[model samples]
Target chain A: MDVETLVLVHQLYGAQSHYIDEGRATEWAHTFTPDGEFHSPSYPAPVVGTAALAKFAEDFAAQPGVTRHVLTNLHVTPADDGLTARAYLQIVRTLPDSPPELLRLTTITDHLVRHAGTWRIRRRTVRRDDTKENR
Target chain B: MDVETLVLVHQLYGAQSHYIDEGRATEWAHTFTPDGEFHSPSYPAPVVGTAALAKFAEDFAAQPGVTRHVLTNLHVTPADDGLTARAYLQIVRTLPDSPPELLRLTTITDHLVRHAGTWRIRRRTVRRDDTKENR
Candidate 1:
């Protein structure tokens, strides 16, 4: 992929993490397309569309401790449809007066498209590293 | 700065981690300039020059257990002389029959220059997150 697209993808991931961490559900959901879809091992069914995506972010942000989605090792490539991005996600959590914990490690695969001159995720799939399928 | 330079810097970090993880000391050291320097709070003094850099990598690899350098949140900017890149580093270690542990978290700052058509680190400074300065 061209350097510009790659940087944009990285920035998009950063924005996603920041929005969700700050409990900005609408903002976080908007990082995806209007009809964006999210599939994850943690969810029984894929979350589809803007409203559902927003609700998903809301539920996640409602959890007890502060969380950070640390993204790393991003690999980006141009695809026939749009752009394909794969990254490692480390979810760290911490509570008041306690050391931060490495909550989970997972891989994120994203299909992104440029809509109205801004890159947005069309689909995202997450696989947890500790899961049986991964092992 | 420009996207192409940004991509090269990210790739350099990936190569650095891979070479050190596989115990390719010379290769890892070569990722830096001939007179590259590394300063870390864990060490009493800075490691300088290609020879010392190689020795540093060798010493790190000699330690027991498998280690992976997880790099994240890279921020790159153009400096007067070269590119300045900052990234979060998570040193994860795993031993036989044991789950991986996040051994340390640190911040890495690198001053990089283009030499012989390749990006090379001129200097790298590492500060541990658990250290007094960070906390």
Candidate 2:
């Protein structure tokens, strides 16, 4: 991918993280396509479609404590359909009167597409690095 | 900053992190200019020049545990001379039979200059988030 594409994708990651963490459910969902799909062991089942995605993020926002997604080591590649990318994600949570906690460590794979001149996630699959299968 | 410059600066962060974590001290030092300087509250004094930079990283390389620099929330702006950037950094360490630990949390500010068509750090200042002054 060209530098412009890489920077755009990186900004997408930043936007998604902030939207979700700050309880902007609709904005977070919009980071994805209308038919975007999120598959992860953290969730009981895949979240498909914009409505479902928004609801999923809303539910998390309703929970206690603040959650911050710390993502690192992003690698992006050009794909026939769009762009494929991988990144290491660390979910950190800080509660009142408690130290920030490391909630989960996982790897996220994203299938991104350009929608209306901006990058959006078409599909995202997350795998827990702490799991036996990953090891 | 333009997307291209943003991408180059981001890649510079990636390169420096890998080189230092992998104990390539000289290579890590080369990520900066020959007269580069690093100032951090973690260090007793500022490390200046190529030789001092290499030696600083070399000493860290001799440490026992594996350290990974997790950087996030990068913001870059064009400067008169080059580019100025800031990022949140979390240093994580893992030892034999132990869970990965959050070593430190800090904010890094960099004055980056283009050297030979690639971005290199001219100066870097780091402030610990845990410090009272920062809080």
Candidate 3:
């Protein structure tokens, strides 16, 4: 990818993490395409569509205690004949209360597309590092 | 930040992981510059020079049981006035014995430079996900 494209993707990744960490659920949902999909080991089925995505983010934000998602090691590659890109990232969640705790370590695979001149996630799959299936 | 540079960096990352996983310690050491430096939370001080680097790789390989390093989410950017690049990546170790187990989750920050038309790591620092200091 060109420098501009790489920077834009990085920005998208950062914004997605920030919105969720800050409890901006609606904005977090906006990081996805209108018909985006999200799947996690914690969820039995994938969440699809903007409304469902919003609800998912909102529920996560409403949970007790504060959470910060630390994202790193992002690998981006072209996919779907160049129409979309695939990104693999690692996420670490920290909870600070009483004693600060490391909550989870997960890998996220994202399928992104340039929609209306902006990069948006079309699909995201979360794999927990502690899970047997993930290994 | 051009496509060529990005692709080369990606290749270097893949080769490094493959060399270690496949027990090619010397080759793994060669992925670094002659005077490369490596630091990790497990080490009290950084390991420098090709000979020391090879020893480190050999020691890691001598550990009991088979280990595979799963690297993902690589973010690369220019550094040192374009003479070097900085890459951040996440690593997960998987061991397959009685059953598959996820052993560790860590983030690696690498400084790379081009030498004789090949990209080599100048420095690498590892941070563990579960550490309080890392968060």
Best by TM-score: 1
Model 1: per-residue Cα lDDT over A1-72, one tens digit each: 567776777788778899999899999999999999999987899999999999999998999989998877
Better lDDT candidate (1, 2): 1
Ranking, DockQ, top scorer first = 1, 3, 2
Candidate 1 lDDT by residue in tens digits, B1-135: 766787878867755775776688999999999999999998999999999999999999887766668887788988889989999888886564445688899999999998889989999999999988973
lDDT, residue B88, candidate 1: 88
Clashing pairs in model 1, backbone N/Cα/C closer than 3 A: none
Q: Which residue pairs collide in model 3, if any?
A: A73-B73, A73-B74, A73-B89, A74-B73, A74-B74, A75-B73, A75-B74
Off by over 4 Å in 1: B1-3, B11-68, B73-88, B93-100, B105-135
**Residues A3-71 of candidate 3: C-alpha lDDT, one tens digit per residue:** 667667767877887888788888899888899999998788899988998898888888767767766
lDDT of 3 at A102: 46
Model 3: DockQ score: 0.16
Assess each prediction's global lDDT (C-alpha) against the native. Answer: 0.83, 0.82, 0.70
The predictions' CA RMSDs to the true structure, in order, are 5.6, 5.5, 6.9
> Which 10 residues in a row give candidate 2 chain B its minimum summed lDDT?
B92-101
A45-129 per-residue lDDT for model 2 (tens digits): 9999999999999998988999898878676778899998777678889999999988666667889998878899999999664
By lDDT rank, best first, the candidates go 1, 2, 3
Cα lDDT of candidate 2 equals: 0.82
Better of 1 and 2 by TM-score: 1
Clashes of each: 0, 0, 7
Model 2 misplaced stretches (Cα beyond 4 Å): B1-3, B12-68, B72-89, B93-100, B104-135
